[model samples]
Target: MTATSTTAPIRIGVMGAHSTGKTLLLQRIEMTLRGYGIPVNRTGQLGKRAALVPLPKMQHHTVASTEWVLAQGIADEIAAAARPGPEPIQVVLADRAAWDALAYWHAAQEWRQETPHRHDRERLLVLAATQAPKYHLLLATALDPDIPVDSRHAYDTRYRTLVDQHTHRLLAAEGIEHHRVTSDPDSQARAVDRAVKLCLKEAVV
Candidate 1:
């Protein structure tokens, strides 16, 4: 890996509900960034790896599960920024972020009719926004009418949609800077390219 030109590596998050093409987009964007000789660390689906119960078997996970995944995601992002190599990682492409985890926690609570645990919510929000190395650009994959949702997630359309809605609501409430990438795959990749370029430009300035 090559060292990054900047002291802090640039972070970019690709976020959306399950099967919204976030992983594919993250891979493509990472490839593009690397072509420019940017040292990159691409993280994919932290929740899947961190969750105690396999995602396919669970409708909703416990708060401890959510917190565990959140902590793992934050730790990975921080470590990527601080990693030692020939070059600092210039770009860190994340499949989803801490905010996404928090959103899922909110959605799960709603589904179970559990009360709002304000402290947990606040803790996550603060860590995602402040303690964690924030994403310079967060690319959100919107659910477009033309693109059908992948059925592998048990095809619970209502649940998936609810999670998506909650994710959007949390993003808005936290005032995170993000752009929705919609349309076809080519357009989505282009959107990511543009966002990354803009972020790099700003980093230069």
Candidate 2:
């Protein structure tokens, strides 16, 4: 669904595994919108902030960490949308959507071969989905093993793959509408174009 209220900023949320170009995609969208003179705000680096909470992250993510990530992302989006300014922000870009944490948590559980409590799992899913409706557009990146990553950082290939799988799986399970961005440059460009068009079109509505 499109943004219905003129007062509320159109929110575009991107989610995917680490180093999957989620941040870059949002940056491109932000730049394009700003070029059109659209005031925009972007929220990101939630994983880093969550790590500061002294909470387990990455392959070690726990329910507490996941909840914190989801809640904090929601709060950040709200604050961005409500930013006080003369121009008034027309769009808010969320780097990692709320359900991202849920995908990571699922990947962590599978990596550790641990079975979490059913109630806790369901609760987190519900919490993560709370912000789903607020997103005017959602983008999910697909991991491409062929696309080499930075050699400086040591990433767990297996776990990273798991996160990618779970990310798409969760999205499909929930039947949430989203654009799937791949490693192809053309695909990335199209995703950015879609986001830009969506914001501009919704703004005039």
Candidate 3:
């Protein structure tokens, strides 16, 4: 594998629309990589219709399942980055990134959370600047534009379009290679594996 190197294992983030198989894809990556005895880390917060609410005090808010998945993703990526290793690849699977922007953008447009406009750049800046370390591999998913949407989902898709488009470009500009996984889980997972191979190309002997 010949890919960009930062004197450490590459950092990765996996995020896509619902049912795009973000978790499934991550599972595949982990299963496949672990066969080689390489180090990997995984965490996610899924927004199922009904999921466990572990935090009693914060139960009122009852954070949605999707938020939990994204939070785990963020944390796992940060943890993986903190370690130094001789292996060429360390993979972190995050089911969603830039998820909060959905509510933030919606509030700006409908609830008047702020001005009438919300910018992807602003939300993006916040994500990149997190206390958590940054990622080098960003495997993004294209929303199945055909999927039906409720009012909330409709708004989310709109914001995701801008966010997704610019995220790929931003990472590339920073020398982080980008890959897009489609609707099919197997195909998407294969694409992710290939992307990792590409990112680790420089490490191949």
Report the lDDT tens digits of candidate 1 across residue range 62-146.
6676777777777788777777898767677767776777777777777777876788767766766653346666777776545
Report the number of the highest-lDDT candidate. Answer: 2
Residue runs of model 3 more than 4 Å from their true location after superposition: 1-5, 46-74, 80-89, 98-124, 127-133, 145-177, 185-190, 199-205
Per-residue CA lDDT of model 3 for 137-177, tens digit only, reads: 55766667776656664354544454445445444554444
Q: Output the number of the TM-score-best candidate.
A: 2
Candidate 3: deviation at residue 95, Å?
A: 2.7
lDDT of 2 by residue, 108-186 (tens): 9999999989999999989987777788889999999988999986888999999999999999999888999999999
Q: TM-score for candidate 1, please give it.
A: 0.82
Comparison by TM-score, 2 against 3, better one:
2
Q: How many residue pairs in model 3 have overlapping backbones? A: 12
The window of 10 residues in a row where model 1 has the poorest summed lDDT is 1-10
By TM-score, rank the candidates, best first.
Answer: 2, 1, 3
User: What TM-score, computed on C-alpha atoms, does each candidate reach?
Assistant: 0.82, 0.95, 0.54
